[model samples]
Target: MKNNRFLSILFICLLLAVGVSAQNTVKTSVPDTIIIPVVPDSDTIGIARVRNELAAAKLNEANMRMEIELLKYQADAADSLKQAKQMQRIDSLRALTPGVPVVVTGDTLFYLYAKRGGYTPQQRAQMDADAIEELGKRFNLNPDSVYIESTDIVTDIMYGNKVIVSFTDQDGLWANCSRDQLAAKERQVIVQKLKELKEEHSAWQLGKRILYFILVLAGQYLLFWLTSWLYRKLKVRIQKLKDTKLKPISIQNYQLLDTQKQVNLLIFLANIGRYVVMLLQLLITVPLLFSIFPQTKDLAYTIFSYIWNPVKSIFWGIVEYIPNLFTIIIIYYAVKYLVKGLRYLATEIDSGHLKITGFYPDWALPTFHIFRFLLYAFMIAMIYPYLPGADSDIFKGISVFVGLIVSLGSSTVIGNIMAGLVITYMRPFKLGDRIKLNDTTGNVIEKTALVTRIKTPKNELVTIPNSFIMSSHTVNYSSSARTYGLIIHTEVSIGYDVPWRKVHQLLIDSALATEGVSADPEPFVLETSLQDWYPVYQINAYIKEADKLTQIHSDLLQNIQDKFAEADVEIMSPHYMAMRDGNESTIPKEDIKPQTTGTGSTKPA
Candidate 1:
């Protein structure tokens, strides 16, 4: 672009200089009429007067011709100045904005500024250049036949009935000229450019171009090979350096990356650089090859544009998006710090360092997570407009698509999450609580957003979904065990011979002897039912450790049997009692020996 501007300035200066020199050189050719002596009455003086008048008239005639030629020179110089000024103005406009130059084989004939119909200036310019190039490929293209046809609205520059370009008033306005002049000037340029292209594309010129094409391809291949070879050598050298020179990357004694990773990173960077070299080679080589052939000359520029246009668009897009990018960053940080503060508050609440009215401390962390998610979501909504291409159809479409997929596929997941949230706030059973749900009794070990895990007394693990847990009933033995002890109860039937009071006393004694049973809330026995053969006695004990309820009950039962046996109470089940009136006690009397008395009968003394 700078080179084009310099050439324009040089051209205008040269034209102005020529005009000034021509104006200085201008001189009126007719000299003052020569003065002569008056003729005498004699024939010699009369003839001298007559010859002098004729010579003076002839000089006057010659001067008239010189004046006419000088006037024509002045008119030509004025036209030249006008042309130079107009070109200078057009060049100025071209430099101010983007304009496509009509280039043919490295020479820029002119730039196209105005777009007609659907074609942009760049596309129009390329089409025209391509037409001209294609015209040169013809065997019998006549430059003399190239002419300009001016109409009321447009002027067409044609080459043998083919319209090279249709110039409109807009183009003339851009050039600071009438449509007719623009067309005429451009027609000459096109003809001359086409002639040059024809000569360059001649057989001998084509042979040289082909040679140059081959050389470029060979050079590109060699560069690619050399790049690969050099990269392999660097890869090996990096590996060697890992053992010999490279140490682990660390920050203040903490290893961030090991030596092997550093070597790998070096090799990765080298590989990327190699790829970039290959890409650069292609970018240069492909365009060169295309420009080498006149037929593909436009293609060279088209390919260049293919790469350049996107790069320019991306660069400008980033530049234009800087303010919005800043806005997004600001929003992100604002929300981030807000959430950080919230997390700290939640931590204080969970640790019981802080408290809120009617808010349970256990609900703190999950509530923070919920609020954090909502805050981040709101931040995204606020920043959406500031995101580059966020308003584009593709971005919106993709968002909608992902939303649809989530809605369709994650119904169960969403349900479980909601249930988990409810369970958290409801304070159902927390970790390490002994709970029973749907006949599965176990101690809660883990709780998550999706499921709650428990380990049964038998050490069997059970995973119940939050949704399922929400719908079913739950019994939490450990929830109230510490505040109000859990009542551990069992039933046993004894014969009617044992008085209800005595039976109750024995049961209470056994329960109070149990390890996990609390004696402060003294053990109690309930006579649940009295049947014809036996009475059912229920022994209940208060226990702080609900988790040891099973083991405590087992020990209580064993203690009950031992206490009844020590008293010789003969605690008999209804199934074992045959004769209620006269039967030896089921408990054997210690220190009583059995002796034989006549027949094979044993008796206790």
Candidate 2:
């Protein structure tokens, strides 16, 4: 503006200087160039010279006007250059001037360089930002409400009653633009930002979001319904499969999991899948719903991050666990195959196909089981580190607690297992072997790590703890019956009147006549005890079958009675001796004497 004023004053000075130069030129000019006309003799020559002089004067006047215009053009050029330099200087000052950015939705629209006396540029920028934010928050507001007002010093870019920002001449100077131009530009920017904010949160946009949300919910419900329906269908199919495809999972003769347990496991897995899918749908839908509204847009992202963080962590945990999982799988399979091979070897040995010296076939399976248990324990120890959350205190704590419980509660059980192992290698008895343990004599039927079951001769089942068996004596009669023959012996009392040789011969003959008696190893009789009135005659006979000991003994006693009755050799009893020698009543007629008394009922006599 000062440059403009200077240019105007220079134009006025040029006009005055031109007027003075013209007057001076008029004063300095020769009076009609009389000296030039003197050389002209003729009137025609004088008239031609005068016309030439007038042409010269017009030419000189045109040249003087050209000089004046040239001088003015130079002054204008100087002023333009000076103004450009001042503009450059202002631009440099503006570059050095600190400004606060007016940010909207994380984007900086412009800088606020103007500051009041009480407020810094930052504070001014905050006011502007707050105004724009308040305006944008109105979903029903229109961008056309934004307008500008020009005052003597400042231009205000306003929306309704809110001033978004204002521009002054100083501000324009800083921006290197006019006040109105800067204000208009700022207004345009603010209005455009407000329009974007309004559009984003408008009813139409919200409706679209609602539609999307509905679609998502519909899809989610559909998935849930599908999952449930599929689960029901699978349940029905599984129920049907219970009678068809599903069976108890068994290893050899041992059932690991029942058919019903398998069905329940499958159903549980299906339910878990359903919950996971529904939860995933909810995660997606809730975030999308939140994001539809501009006010909750950041909240939407926050919620998404919250929900996705765990999912992402779990996914990454699984991904990272893959290598460990593979390692565990490999270790499991290696141990499994090794155990399988050992089991095969044990089976071979147990079936008597394979034999080792001093190692009985009965020892094979139990030893294999011990080795398998150790291998499984070692496998657990090896694989524990690779398990997810293995490093967690809770996992370690649980493991320690379980181990502590087992160690504390399983003393007797462990003793039994150890005794069972010892009993197995000791080859004390096997299945179907007639054995006597403590006061229980029976055939061994089932043997376990903790207890052994025996079926008695009277069909009574007796379970004996292996630990107790370890401390007690066990007689395995059948152990040598197949080779040597089990001796079945019974004692009979004979009167002293009978000769020892006769008593011995009679008992031996009775044992020989009995069924199930082995004659090759002849029966023998021994005088076990000699009483005052009778002698104990013990007869021993060998039988190939030890399990039939009860039946053989019954038959031997019956045969002894018959042989003694026929031979007239009395098989004496104390009662018979008392009746015969003490002169007891021989008839019922002598012992029964009926005596009737008054008011007494006569009982059978």
What is the C-alpha lDDT profile of model 1 across 89-138, one tens digit per residue? 76877768766898765678888788888899999888988888788876
What is the C-alpha lDDT profile of model 2 across 214-296, one tens digit per residue? Answer: 88778777877887897788778767776788879999999998988898888788778778877877888788878766678
**lDDT measured at residue 303 in model 1 versus the true structure, 0 to 100:** 96
Candidate 1 pairs with clashing backbones: none
Query: What lDDT score goes with residue 231 in model 1?
Result: 91
User: Where is model 1 more than 4 Å wrong at Cα?
Assistant: 1-195, 202-204, 238-276, 578-605
RMSD, every candidate, angstroms: 14.6, 16.3
Q: Highest TM-score: give the candidate number.
A: 1
- The per-model lDDT (C-alpha) reads 0.84, 0.83
